[model samples]
Target chain A: MTGRTIVITSGKGGVGKTTTTANIGTGLAMRGHQVVVIDTDIGLRNLDVVMGLENRIVYDLVDIIEGKCKMHQGMIRDKNKLELFLIPAAQTRDKNCINPEQMKELCAKLEREFDYVLIDCPAGIEQGFKNAIAAAQEAILVTTPEVSAIRDADRVIGLLESEGLHRPRLIINRIRPGMVKRGDMMDKDDITELLAIDILGMVPADDRLIIATNQGVPVIYDKRAPSGLAFSRIAARIDGEDIPLMDLGPKNGIMDKVKEIMGINRGAYSNA
Target chain B: MRDLIRWVVTRKENTKNAARNRLQMALMRDRMDLSPDIINALKIDLLAVMSQYLVVGDEFQEFGIRRLDESVFLVSNIRVKELPRANAN
Candidate 1:
């Protein structure tokens, strides 16, 4: 089948590009589609560790491109599912080792076998970033609800559109509902306005995501985590489902409860 | 108690609002590939050059980024009442 290659990218680092890639890849696989997630961040490869397949990688993306190994030989299957696979990036090789043409060709080969190919792009808009975007037909930009990240995401969107990767959907990650409710942080609405892109999903700040990442088991496996559920909805959207976006109302703590009991309702929870 | 009452009444968050202001300025500056310093210098130079030809009003002489339709403009609107008539009565 000719698969859709969607690249997950963010212009800033630590904004959850890799996490989004891992979760969305896993979520799509959970939907019973054959999916492969590729890490294009060659030298600073962390997707392997994040996916918990670092020990299993004898060959990597560079190896496959350099003809040192077969395509499937370098692919590591996920322990959780048979439908998912990951092609890890080589740690020793730099960004210069792989070019856009090779990446495009590699993606073309993967397109024949998988239903979805999600590439984890590097942070900066350099060669690694270019290679990741080379063969992808669609894009998913990940950004946090901060000025720094949104500014960079806007620049990345312009660059992507210039390359004909039009209308890339956005995923605003690590959104603190409490801060947003207090009007102390940027919310989903503000971020979408800043970036001028269709929002895919809003993943709230969840501590369980940290444990899940460290344990090499994606939060999607937990099922109850807010961020996990948010990611699953994103995957479903990508799979052409019409799921409504979830309302990210902040969790009312003890103070809020007291205020509510006293009839001094905070505006954030007034609608509730 | 004044601060607490003000907070309760106005619901104003100073730091975040201030950040939004800074972000707006920075984003506009980045898009035009010119820093704030450059823009400020340009404004000063423009005012100096224009003062030689016309009298600029303090109230209408403005320099900042403004959004129009879908485009962001680095605009400078100067109100000139007319060159202080070189040979007026």
Candidate 2:
């Protein structure tokens, strides 16, 4: 019943876990909820950088957990979203610097004060994974359509369930519509069928995402970007909204369309 | 014409489908606290045991993927065959 704590994680690196966390955190805040995004990637902090609050992090999560500073003192509020805040990780500390119990306690404490606590988990299922998942009541798994990413995701989902974190929703990132349409890449349907999990959203490979990350700004603020729209829908879904998944279905190419008009239209590739 | 229809229905090997099937098997094995080779061995053992119980001159089909321990893991089914008893006794 307390504020929901959801850990955003991907067993594979560079699958956009941090980006999803930042965007979803910002999206929730944009809807007027008090949200706190925590960087649990310890030693390799990036949530702060992605959120553009790196310059304002006076104290980090390790400091708060270690009692070196008050919890509130370590939280850096987003300059753009007054309702959204960030608890940056300590780049100087290792995963051992804070244990799972400490992180769980932190979540318990934050639950009383915020609407959502989003933890940006470190890649790989190790001590850092244990620490990041320790406090989460729910989990959001991020992965790409690639074989390596999905393989790691399957492993991570197994790991999550073994830890009693069951039914974590999935986010398929960096999907290329063109590739999927041409059957050259993994489609969302295939990925969902493989993982056998509820897919929260799918973000198309968008150049704007890279730009947003470089500028420490989330694409959700742009509203026009496909990835931004996807994140917004995901945030809404998390909020108990029953919005239908977006239609990124494959489209018929010009040649295919032209063939259909002709009498010689190959009925073979029509369904495809 | 028949070949064209077959080709249409039988979509080419897509990168996505390949990834999906691989992931599905991997996750199932993983959640079961086992590996691919282990599950395959289990399936083989299962067939052997099933054959032991089959009547003479009888046949059976192999089981498909089955859920084990709720969501913990899935037992990979290889093939259903005649009860072992039919062939043995």
Candidate 3:
């Protein structure tokens, strides 16, 4: 079956590209779609740890491309989701070890079997970034509310357009709602107006995200976590479900909660 | 307590607004790959050329390179107050 290959990228580092890759991959798998996440970060491989499959990576992306092992040998199944898999990058090799042509060939092979091939792109506009986006049919740019990340994202968007990957959707991560309310941080509207891209989803800054990563788990499994719910909604949207954007404003009062319980109000979270 | 006083003093403009304004200006130049110096020089040259044929206003309503769809254009909207003398070379 033909599958969709999407590269989760951000020109600036530490903006949750890897985390978004892991969560969205797991989120899609939890919905019963067969998925594989390939980390193209090379020497700085961390998708394995994020997916909690670090100890199970016998063969890696380099081995699969170098013909040292079969594709299935390099694929590591997730601890919980059987349909989800991860192809970790080679920790010893440099980004120059692989090229765009090889990456394209590998993605072509994987697309024939899986429903989704999520490429975790490295941070930068260098060789690694080129190799990651070479074969992807779609792109999801991750960024924060800060200026530097947005600036870099704008540049990456221009570069992606030049490369013929048009209309890359945006995912704004680590948004602090309180700060947005206090007029201290940029909101989704401000960012979208400037970036001029379709918003895939908005994830709030949740402490649970850190705890989940510390436990070697993606936060999408934490039902009580707001950021986890955000990721699941994003996955649903990616799966062709028309989930409306969540209202990420401040929490409502007790009276509003009562109204929500009575079905008179849909509450602040799902007001569309 | 100190934050309250500062908030009251700077009530007209917040840091977020400052960021938005700065980002917009930066992106305008960045999207066209034009530096501030180049934009300033172009503005002066265009006004100078227009003044030879028409009584052009010193201030331009809009002047910059903007992207529309797949095409990029050097858009300029200068106010022409009046036309020059017909016999003037």
Among the numbered candidates, top TM-score falls to: 3
Against the true structure, candidate 3 has what lDDT? 0.90
Off by more than 4 A, model 2? A249-272, B1-13, B28-89
Q: Show where candidate 3 strays beyond 4 Å.
A: A254-272, B1-8, B35-85
| Recovered fraction of real interface contacts per model | 0.25, 0.82, 0.75
| Model 3 per-residue lDDT tens digits across residues B6-87 | 8888975678987877788678778877778888988999889888778989989998676665345788898889977778
Question: Per-residue CA lDDT of candidate 1, range A1-272, in tens?
Answer: 99999999999999999999999999999999999999999999988888888888899999999999999999999988899999999999899998989999999999999999999999999988899999999999999888889889988998899888999999998887778777888877767776678999898887778989989888888755778878888999999998877668744678867764775533223210
Candidate 1, chain A: TM-score against the reference: 0.93
Model 2: per-residue Cα lDDT at residue A165: 93
Each prediction's DockQ against the real complex: 0.32, 0.48, 0.67
Poorly placed runs, candidate 1 (over 4 Å): A251-272, B1-11, B34-89
Give the per-residue lDDT digits (tens) of candidate 3, residues A1-272: 99999999999999999999999999999999999999999999999998888899899999999999999999998999999999999999999999999999999999999999999999999999999999999999999999999999999999999989999999999987768888888988999999999999999887888999999999999876778889999999999999888668656688767865775432334422
lDDT of 1 by residue, B5-87 (tens): 98877767545565566666666666677777887788778878888878786543677778765467777788887777768
The TM-score-based order of candidates, best leading, equals: 3, 1, 2
lDDT of 2 by residue, B43-80 (tens): 66765776666532222234345544334334343344
